[model samples]
Target: MSEIVLRNVCKEYEKGNFAVKDFSLDIHDQEFIIFVGPSGCGKSTTLRMIAGLEDISDGELWIDDQLCNYFDPKDRGLSMVFQNYALYPNMTVYGNLAFALKVRKASKSEIDEKVHKVARILEIEHLLDRKPAALSGGQKQRVAIGSAIIRRPKAFLMDEPLSNLDAKLRAQMRIELAKLHKELETTIIYVTHDQTEAMTLGTRIVVMKDGVVQQVETPIELYNHPVNLFVAGFIGSPSMNFFQAHVTEENGRMVVFIGNPKDGKKIYLEGRRSELARLRAMDQDVTLGIRPEDIHEYADAAELGIEKATVGMNVTVTAREMLGAEVFLYFDEQKKTHAVRLHPKNQTMTGEKIDLYFDPKKIHLFDQNTEESIFYREETV
Candidate 1:
């Protein structure tokens, strides 16, 4: 079992300036963990600290109950796959795959067997005899992975291994990597800035910002119940929409007005959500958060029994994207552009007026000053 733990880990480049601050996580064995954030958020630095490539300024690094903060990278038993295919141009794929084993003085037969086995698993057997320069981008990546697999390390640390590939190739490789993780059944800690990769690949994703970990959760949980405004805004493509809102008690129900109270753009909260919001934000300003898919058209609103609550939300379509499977409509509200996903048959053209409704149950409320989700459950964190 390759359980890795970081206890209040930090990386300081200058006095009082940390690249990674108070980062702590317990990574389970064979779990595909992803560290994801925007660039310069200290994700890569945290990965490097785990890999022993960078020094941990504070806190403890433990690998399987052994303190490993001072261990050499090679002795830590972790294989690293970098973004750049770090294969030797002068060496063929087979040679590159066998290099690690040969460095340990393994016999030729053992090296050959392991090399062939890994090549078959990565589907690079046909390119074994070709040098790095002769292989395509995908092929070279496969070779790089095969090289790492031959060592049979305790865990794999990958730093944006597919960032260089095009969109189509990246999609294909994502599938391949998932299959590889299952077959190998080894711990993998991958780092990437792409949310799509994090959502699809990781069993548990670590969302970081400015050297601090914001939340760690499964993809669906993170998407559905983000802990704060930053996470809700960061995880999804086109992200969550936010509007200035105020919460008040109206007719024995908690009501959230989207803009000015006179505009009639408001949503009604019911049952437990109403109780929670009323307890935390009654008669206070809050930010209203809703996903694009949660905002629906007239027919859907009627079906969901939220029609009256959406009475006066009239927005002019500024942009319309017909993405075949689903339609996306963009509109301006309170000087901010908001998006809504509709059925592909949504005939709302650019410059046309459209009425949209929010599903009351799907609404999220955040504290205006703290930006923390008022409805976030502490148990999930």
Candidate 2:
């Protein structure tokens, strides 16, 4: 329903601690933008600033194309759903939903209509007469959301609204929230530390760390093509494995050196010869990044390029997780360990050793200093 923009926004507390710094983002109308990062990453603080709950120490805040730096929270036409379901325990669900309108002395018929409409949308109409103590956690959360919805504000700001729910209920609420977004068509700014929630719910994700915005893109784009080491490591499950490697020219070809002098191995990457050449020319030591799923067990070493520089290393399988369709193989090799995703059929017993191959094309190379992707080209093949 409204666009929110932050231009060079910053927040600083006593002792020169910066909570958020030089942050600028444009959230379009009806878009669900999720701010995600680890705790103390300034995501919640940023949301509070946008909601007019915190003063902007620097820069401008705009809502619906209007400068809202000095505006009151209510006058900004934004509704916020907090992490804790801040429902009045004494009030029934309907009363909780009607409180805001009652404070403004809205007509009795108008209040009833708005509250019931929101309850119906949230599917909590049956629980309207029940107090918070009588409602389940999910029901209470729905009432909290309904309270925000009844206001019909220009935008919705939710800060980890489903954090208190159980895992199963969380999943259900996630779907319901997505449905709510579609039905309301209002700009939503949600904050969460959970990567799964951020990935599944966001139309565009703003990945932040240490008070700085790392990447702002679609979920798939961030997952497939992260901008830096932090985003790469933070955005995925079972996180991408990182190995310090040196880039060297071997026989007119670029290769990344993996493993140490003791039980060492060298992996050669075929594509992006030009990019590797540039990095090598600059004498840069690159970090090799590969997702667990990208490393595959070779059925026939001769069928592929596995013989070129493959090293025979002994891995002690520590644990195996079977997820029906796929299995996770966790193992240790040469004092270093990693998780390799494999078919459920390939679920090797603990202490068993298996041969695995790393796909060069699926590997990512990042500049050691800048931590930016240097070897992976974005142009579609």
Candidate 3:
């Protein structure tokens, strides 16, 4: 089993400057772990350090009980699939897949068997005689993966391996990679800025920003519960909508005033949420977080039993996009654009005004100063 443990790992490029700071995680065997963040967030750099491509400036890197901070990349028993495919243009697919085994002086017959087996798994058997230059982006990637698979390394370290492909090809490759992961049953450490890939493929995701890991959780856990504002904002497509709000007790119930309370728009919190807000942030400003899907139209709000006050948000539709299965309506609120996902049958047009309601149970609250989720559970984190 390939269990990797990082304890307070820091990658300092300069004396006082760091690329990764105090990062720690216990990655279990056969787990599809994703390192996701925006550009230059050090997701790739962290993966590189684990692969021994870069020096670990501080802290320990343990692989299955052994300190691997000083191990050579080749000695680390991890195969890396790169963004560019990294296939040898001069070599045929067969040659590329067989190269690693040849270096170890594996028998010719053994090399052939492993090459064909990996080719079949990756579905590149038909393209074996073709060179890298002749293959499509997906085919070339399959060959690159085949080369790695033939080696049978302890784990796979992939750094944006699907970034170069188009949207359609990327979607296809994502499915293929998921299947490959299952068939091989190996641990995968993948780095990508694409949240879609991370959400779809990862068993657990590590969200990083500016070299620091924000949170690590299962895909559903990260989506439903994020520890901080950055993670809540970063993990979703179209992202989570944020609103400036003030929390205060009204008639013994915690109420949040959206934007200017003079507009007569507010949402009431109840039970644990209200209690938590009362104890920690009564009368303080908070950032209300809600997803597009959580904001519903009047009919939906009524059916969902959301109170009338919460459904009182009146917004002018600035833009409307019909995405076949779902429609996205955008509006300007608090000087920032917010989106709402609705049924494609929505007939609301640009310049029209419509009322929207937030699902109170699905609402998230973050402290304005700390930017930490007020509802964050330390046990889950």
What are the Cα lDDT values of the candidates? 0.92, 0.83, 0.92
Write down the TM-score for model 3: 0.98
Model 2 worst lDDT window (10 residues): 274-283
> Taking the tens digit of each residue's C-alpha lDDT, what string does model 1 give over 258-336?
9889887889888788888888999999999999999999998998888876554889999999999999999999899
Report the C-alpha displacement of residue 155, candidate 1, in angstroms: 0.7
Model 1: pairs clashing at backbone N, Cα or C within 3 Å: none
lDDT of 1 at 222: 93
Per-candidate TM-score against the hidden true structure: 0.98, 0.92, 0.98
Please rank every candidate by TM-score, starting with the best. 1, 3, 2
On TM-score, who's better, 2 or 3? 3
Candidate 2 segments exceeding 4 Å error? 261-264, 273-277, 280-283, 300-314, 376-381
lDDT by residue (50-73, candidate 2, tens digit) is 999999999999988899999999
